[model samples]
Target: MKYVVAWRERPTGSAAEYEAAQKRIREVLALWKMPASLTIHQFVARVGESGYAALETVEPADLQYLIAAFAPFSITVVPMMEVLDVAAGEPRGIEWRNGLPCTQP
Candidate 1:
C-alpha cells in the first residue's frame, strides 16, 4: 500500500521542539513493520509551515502503527493505488491536452 502522511507542525514552537517531533516520527516509521514496500518523499511546503511525506509500503497495517506512534499529534494517512497509465517511467500519451495546470497550450 502507498500512503501520503502529512504532519502539521506546531506554530508557536521552537526549532528544538519541532525537531523532536520529527525525530519521533522517523523512529516510529523505522520500527513499523508493514506489508507494502516503502518509499518516502517529503513534500514541499506550501501555504502553511506543515510538512508531509508520501510513502509506498507493502503492509497496510503500518499506517495504524504510525498513527499510534504519533499519538497526540495530528497525522493523516491515505492509501493510494497507482494508475497504470500514469505509472512512473511510462510514456504519457498526447491525450493530455494543453491548458492543464502545468502545461502550455
Candidate 2:
C-alpha cells in the first residue's frame, strides 16, 4: 500500500511556529526506529501563497506515524494505488478499472 501525504502552513500559523514544528519532527524521526518505506517525497512552494505543499509516497503502516509527525501543520493523507500515464494512455504501475484507478486500502 502507498499513501500521499500533503501538508501546508495553517492560515494563522507563523514561520516561527512552522520552524518549531519542523524541529520536533526532526527529533521524532531521529529517535524513531521504523522501516524506510518512503518512495517519493516532494516539497512545493508557490510564489505568492503563504503556505507550501509536501507530497510523499509511503507505506500504509507509516501513514499514522506521518500524520502524527506533521501534526503541527494542516495535512491530508490519501491512499493511492496506481499511476496513470495520460499521454501514453496507460497505467504505469497498476491497473485501472471501471474508468477509475484503484486506491490503496
Candidate 3:
C-alpha cells in the first residue's frame, strides 16, 4: 500500500530550545537508516523545519517504526490512492450520491 508521510518539529519555547531540538533531530537523522521494507518515492524538506515523503510498503509495522525513530517530531501518516486509480473504479451504485460523476449513467 502507498502512504504519505509528513513531520514537523513541535513548537519550541525559545531560540535555545529550537536549537537544541534541531540538534536532536539532526542526530536522529544521522543515526537512522531507511527500512528495507519500504520503497521511498520522494523525500523532501521545507525550510529545515518540516519534512514530507511518499512511501510504499506492504508492512504496516514500518510506519510504526518510523514514528518511533523520529520521536522528536510530530508525524502524520495517511493512506493514499492515486487520483486516476480512484477515477477508474467501477461506478456502479454511485449515481444516487450527489455531486459525483458516474460513468455508467
Candidate 4:
C-alpha cells in the first residue's frame, strides 16, 4: 500500500524553539526509511507557518511508527489508491487531441 504523508507544523509561541525543532525534524525524516522514488518537501507558500511532504510505498502501520517517533509534531496521513484502468485508452478517460494521430472516436 502506498501513502502520501504530508507534514505540517503548527505555530509555536517561541520562534527560536520552532526553528530549532524544525531543523531537528529534517534530520529525523532523513534518518527514516523513506521511499526514494517519492516526492517530499516542506510547504513553500506558507514557509515556517507550515510544512508539507508527500510519500509513497508506505504502510498504514508505518504512519503510527512515524508519529510516535516524532512526538510533539502534528502529522497527517492520507492513503491513496492507484487507478487501474481496465477499459481504457486513458485512465481519466479524457482526450483533447486536435491534430494528433490518436483522436477520440
**lDDT, model 1:** 0.65
Instruction: Compare the candidates by TM-score and give the number of the best one.
Output: 3
Determine which window of 10 residues in candidate 1 has minimal summed lDDT: 89-98
Residue pair clashes in candidate 4: 43-52
lDDT of 2 at 63: 62
Ten-residue region with minimum lDDT total, candidate 4: 36-45
**TM-scores for the candidates:** 0.46, 0.45, 0.80, 0.50
Q: What residue pairs clash in candidate 2, if any at all? A: none
User: Per-residue lDDT for 1-105 in model 1, tens only?
Assistant: 667887675443788877887687678767856444556755554574565777877766766776776674677787666787356524444435443477546
Q: How many residue pairs collide in each prediction?
A: 8, 0, 0, 1
Could you tell me the TM-score of candidate 1?
0.46
Local accuracy of candidate 3 as per-residue lDDT tens digits, 30-92: 989978999989999998578899999999998999999888889999999888877776354
- Which has the better lDDT: candidate 1, or candidate 3? 3
Better of 2 and 3 by lDDT: 3
> Which candidate tops lDDT?
3
Tell me the alpha-carbon RMSD of every candidate. 8.7, 8.9, 4.9, 9.1
How does residue 85 of candidate 1 score in lDDT? 32
**Cα lDDT for residue 60, candidate 2:** 65
